[model samples]
Every structure is written in structure tokens, then in C-alpha cells.
Target: MKRFWNWNQDGDQRQLAISGVIAPDSWIHDNVSPQVFQDELNESQGPIDLWLNSPGGDCTAASQIYTMLMNYPNDVNVKISGIAASAASVIAMAGTTVSMAPSAMLMIHNPLTIVGGQEKDLDHAAQMLVETKEAIINAYELKTNLPREKISAMMDDETWMNVNKAIELGFADQMLGDDHQPTDCYSYSDKQSDLVVLNKLKRTSQNTISVKSLQKRLSLLSH
Candidate 1:
């Protein structure tokens, strides 16, 4: 089985690279499950320098990973080396300090699922998605301090943010570079703060459509 995450310890900081799709072990062979990640994290010492590059995948998996990172005792400095979209964006929110590459991007949107059943089942699925969206909002709201309604609206529109825009909107703390000091914040045009993702949208797979698989994956989320 191929692994989606790579870990390397240097000095007191543990470097974790999260790439490709995030999913439970039973769901797929190539994706990284939250349990496997947690096992590695439990044994690590000191702070974490997590490098994230993913188009997102199973939300249940992402939610567990997010919770683990949030509950970690030490600091978790997230470095966005590439795009972090959908469920991957949720994991990014666990960062104590989030830094984005100059050309990197981030995206968030409402959760989606494929349901096959009667009218009542469909209604149940819709309600579940609504609740899931609220749960996801908790993470983003905690990180960005943006209003829940505003965040909902952004998710409704499938918001995409670039480096400067990410900092402006509180999705990111600062731009990654050697020239800028750690405390320096990036600047953005008020009018251009919400730019369309354009060509990059194609790079990210549809990771939010795993709600149908949640029932099967929930067992892996046990603490």
C-alpha cells in the first residue's frame, strides 16, 4: 500500500508532508488514514512543521486529522507548499500559524455526497450535510474569526484564496519567503481580495463527494 503522508524528524521539530488524497485505510490503499497519522504523531516530540499539498479527500478522515492536530500539546506550524482545498483546507485550519507559499492557494466549499435511496433518505442526507457544514465552519471560524454567516456565504460560493487574499481573509497568517519577517503580513487589494481560481480548479479532484462512504469510515475515527 502506498502512503499519502511522509514523516521526517530533524532536531526537535517533526516534519510531516501530507500530499495526495486523505481517506480512511479501508476506503482506499493510496490515501492516508487518520489512525496511521495519529500513531506517528503520538510518538513524535516537540513542535511540528507540517507541509500540506492536497486537493482534499474524505471529510471524515480530514476531521479526525484536524482534531488530532488541534489537540496536540505543541505548536503546529503549517506550511502550504501547494493548494489545500476542500477537506484539506479543514486540516490546514489546525495550524497554530499557517504560512502560504507565494503562489500557493486555498479553497473551501460546502460538503457534497452521492446518495441513492428514497425521498426520506435523500432528505436525511441533506440534513447531514448541513450539520457537517456547520461542524466544518467551527474549525474555520476558530482559525479565521470570520462570521459564521460570512463563512457560510463564502463556502456557498466555493471561495478560492491566493496568498495575499488568504492573509487578508485570515485564512493564512503570513506569506512564506525569506525576505519578509515572520511578523510581516501580506497586502492585498480590497477589490481583488476574492479572485476566481481559474485554471487551478482542475487540479483538485472532487474530494467532498465521500459522504456516502462516511458510514463505513466512521469506525476508524475512534480515539
Candidate 2:
């Protein structure tokens, strides 16, 4: 697996880019293990600018990263430059100042599991999933302060939020960087191919194009 954290030094400005899947082997090549993340976080000090572009993975792994960030005795600002979905959204909750690029997306959903076993085994798995869902909700509740029922309903629907909605819903705190500039371009895994259709990027100052618009454009392409 490729190491996901690295220093990007531009003159005196430094930042760590968390720019892919959250857990080991989420994709065939790029994955971040908890050990790898811990090692990187420990080696780095002072103020950190964390740039996120992830579709999320491995809730336990994300939770560990979130805890580590929260415990670090330094200012850590999170900037979502592309997409922060699932477990990635959970990690973003740790930011002292969480921000989203204009075109970035944030998604949240109930815990998911795939299982096939005896009835008792299935029952146990279901119970575990329920506990995990609650834990995930706890992170959102702490960050958003929205009613638990509302949050739960959104999660149940696998809701997708763009930059404005993310901030409005309390998933993010601010809009980061130059507003005129285009958000960073990223590629989702083939697993997400069915959801994201590849389209040539189109941007304009007259209108702010969003992920939802891109999805609609892609949907049109498919038909």
C-alpha cells in the first residue's frame, strides 16, 4: 500500500495531504494503515494543514485518526479539497477548523456490513452494526449539534452534501482557499464507477458548478 501522508513544502508553507482511502487495501494500491498514520503524525509537529480528498473507509481506522488528531497538542486545520465521504467524514470532524472547497462533497450513511452465517452469527453482526452506527452518529452529533433523529434519518438515506450544505448542516466550518480557483480534480475507485460517470470538467464564473451538477451531467451521458 502507498503511504498517504507526506509533506508538501512550498517555500515556508507546509501541509500534509491525506488524499486517498482511509484504511489499508481500500483500493489495490493506495491505503493508509493506522500504524502508518500514527508514524507520520508523530514525526510531524507544529501547525498542520490537513488536505482531504477521500471517499472514506474502515471506520475503526478513521476513528483512530480522528482521536490522534484531537489529542495532538497542535493546531490542525482540515481542508476538504474534493470528497470526504463515509469514514473520511468522521475524521474531518476532528479538525479545529474544518473547511470545504466549493465543489467538494461530504457523505454520511449508516454502518454497513456483509455477512453470511448462522442466525445467531447474523444477529450478533446486526447488533455490532447497530453499536457502530451509534458511535458514528456520536461524532456527527458532537460536531453538528443537530437533533439525533434528523442526523439518523440523513444517515439512513446515504445523504450527500455539497460545500454549502456541509457547512450549513455543521459538517464543516468554513469555505477554504481561493473561491475563484477550481477544486482539485480526483478519481474515485472503480467500485464507485457506477455512481460517478467520467465527464470532461466544465467550469464558469457565471455559475458555481457542483458535484450534484456533475452527477446530473453524468447521468445524462449514460442515457
TM-score of each: 0.78, 0.72
lDDT for residue 162 in candidate 1, whole number 0-100 = 91
lDDT on C-alpha atoms for all candidate structures: 0.77, 0.72
Candidate 2: which pairs clash?
Answer: none
Residue lDDT tens for model 1, 150-208: 99999999999998788787788767883345424555532222111111121122457
The local distance difference test score of model 1 is 0.77
Local accuracy of candidate 2 as per-residue lDDT tens digits, 1-223: 6565676765544587886877655532334466677777777567678899998877777888888887766667789999999999998887766778878899999888789989999999999999999998888876666789999999999999987777667676667764333222222233234221221132111238774676676677668
Which runs in model 1 stand beyond 4 Å of their true positions? 24-32, 183-185, 188-223
At residue 11, candidate 1 shows an lDDT of 86
> What's the CA error at residue 55 for candidate 1, in Å?
0.4
